[model samples]
Target: MVTAAIGLEFVKQFLNLNNPPEFVFACCRDPATATDLKEIVKSNSSVIIVELDVTKQESVEKAKSHVASIVGTKGLNLLINNSGLINSQRIGDVTREDMLKCYEVNAIGPLMVAQAFLPLLRQAAGQQSSEPMSCSKAAIINISSGVASITENSSGGMYPSRASKAALNMITSNLSLDLKTDGILCTAINPGWVKTEMGGPNALITTEESVEGIMSVLEKLKGEEDSGRFYHGVKGQTIPW
Candidate 1:
């Protein structure tokens, strides 16, 4: 539901462009169960919905296959690693299992997705035959959080989410260096206090506004030189490590 809402808003604005970009919305659950998302797929024939479980390697591979079969060797121009989960637990109350689960989903998942989809991204960078390829740039956007920066609150609890996001930031920095030669820009983006299922009711921003600001930032991303840095939403600011 969260994925559908965010994707719908982003795609609605994205399709409004003078030249709309091709898009795909991937999820772990069956598409048949997501009627609202299915409506999006129906309304936008250009948008493809695929089943993807970022936490599972097999699921990621299956998603890659589905994408390859649909888009072919040309590759994807942009990859948004927006899949994440948050658990509210205090430090003394934290459990080992939950900590591992948080790391798997928040940190390792994006890394797996990046590794799995890199060939296609590299292909997108190399292909000169198409419009997306004509741009000659591929980017990976890792959605992160503010808690990753200040761990004061984390010391008492919520260690998993905070620590994992920090690790994700590190992964983005490292990937920016590793993929620079391939012309794949990898960066972490803090979406701010958006009111989603995870962000709760009192959050400062709505998902629509947050995504709008994020898309704006993404549309302006140029090349590998912009990789590895941390960007805050539509305010056009950078977050310190």
Candidate 2:
């Protein structure tokens, strides 16, 4: 719901395309909380909401099946591994379970989604109509964080959040290399400090602004240019590993 409400809204308004791209929102909770999303589906029949627990492989597979049924064999053109969790605990305060939970959602979740959806992404890349202008390339965007960049203890706590994002960046880079031949582009984006529930009240940007910036990055994506790079949202620059 958050992705659809914040991320896709920016994509829809900023892109200004003739038609809105179909969207599938996968969540672990009940879809009823997404009242705004439900309204979007009412207006645009192409939107789908499915139950998905990214931490579990079974849940991911079920969600994939549901999406496949909706979009048919054409498959997904874009996959955004945006689902994540943050546990704010200092090094000594952090527990083993907390660290594991963070890794499950932020690192392993994206990897599972990528592996499960590879065929769909490949299908989208190979899609060609009798008219060449109708085809579109496939892409994957993984939401990473600035914590992944530095090893400093400036933040004090939040070890789980920091480590998971770093792991996510590594996953993104590896996936990009593996999927390059298949014409699937994968890149990690640090969406900057935005005032989401996770970003807290002192965040620098609004969720809308951050999403707009990320969408700008997404729009400029070209097959030859940025596939495996780590993007910094605020400066719109690439971050080196």
Candidate 3:
């Protein structure tokens, strides 16, 4: 799976894996300021750092160019949309600016990234021509949330995060339909309440646990019909939409 440096958990998992030869491109906005991310780079030679700002078209196009150069004939097997924005604001207390900004990053950013990298995904599918005619194709894993679930909103607060994630789900569903013809698989995953900056210290899962579960999901999931499905990060269980 191609995981971005939204959190180093996925990166850490990829680095430690003793599996088949799958390239991991750690795309982010600024590698220079990413001290923790840079430190991870010191240990691994396969990880390629490409500058990407998913919120901006120009930055994504530039990043696509850089990744394309690196991935010449091979193309990309997976594109992981892990970058997210969370604005903790109550419904009445939320500012207009924060609401829009949340949607821009959480919802729209993934769309832009997927659009920019589609050709590369197609290339990867073509490269695997000898494989069986299965739905196990090029994939895009979107790090979505349980908060976005309209069926499970018991507390009903986090307006910005909830709304933006819901929008992201819509994008994922449409993307699956739109890209399936090209043998591209697209799906959304809720990483659960992990102890990250956004998930906070009291959360149930650790980054390691979350990443482990996510990796399993990417490895085992199958079929084009499975694309656009919302998966709970724990053991790739199907979540109710």
lDDT of 1 by residue, 1-241 (tens): 1244555566666667778876554454466787766777777887777787777899889888888887787788778888778877877788999899999988998899889988888888776422331123677888888777753343545788888988999999998899777777788888888787778899999987888888788777775556788888758677887
Residue ranges of candidate 2 with Cα displaced over 4 Å: 1-16, 22-28, 128-136, 151-156
Q: CA lDDT of each candidate?
A: 0.76, 0.73, 0.80
- For model 2, where is the 10-residue window of minimal lDDT? 128-137
Better of 1 and 3 by lDDT: 3
Model 3 clash pairs are none
Give each model a TM-score: 0.90, 0.87, 0.92
Q: In model 2, what is the error at residue 77, expressed in angstroms?
A: 0.5
**Clashing residue pairs for model 1:** 27-52, 90-157, 91-156, 91-157
Question: What would the TM-score be for candidate 2 when compared with the true structure?
Answer: 0.87
**Top candidate (TM-score):** 3
Worst 10 residues of 1 by lDDT: 128-137
Query: Which candidate leads in lDDT?
Result: 3
Q: Write the per-residue lDDT of candidate 2 for residues 101-206, one digit (tens) a residue.
A: 9999889988998888787878787773221211147877888888777643365678899888889999998988887777778899988887877778898988
Model 2 lDDT at residue 226: 80
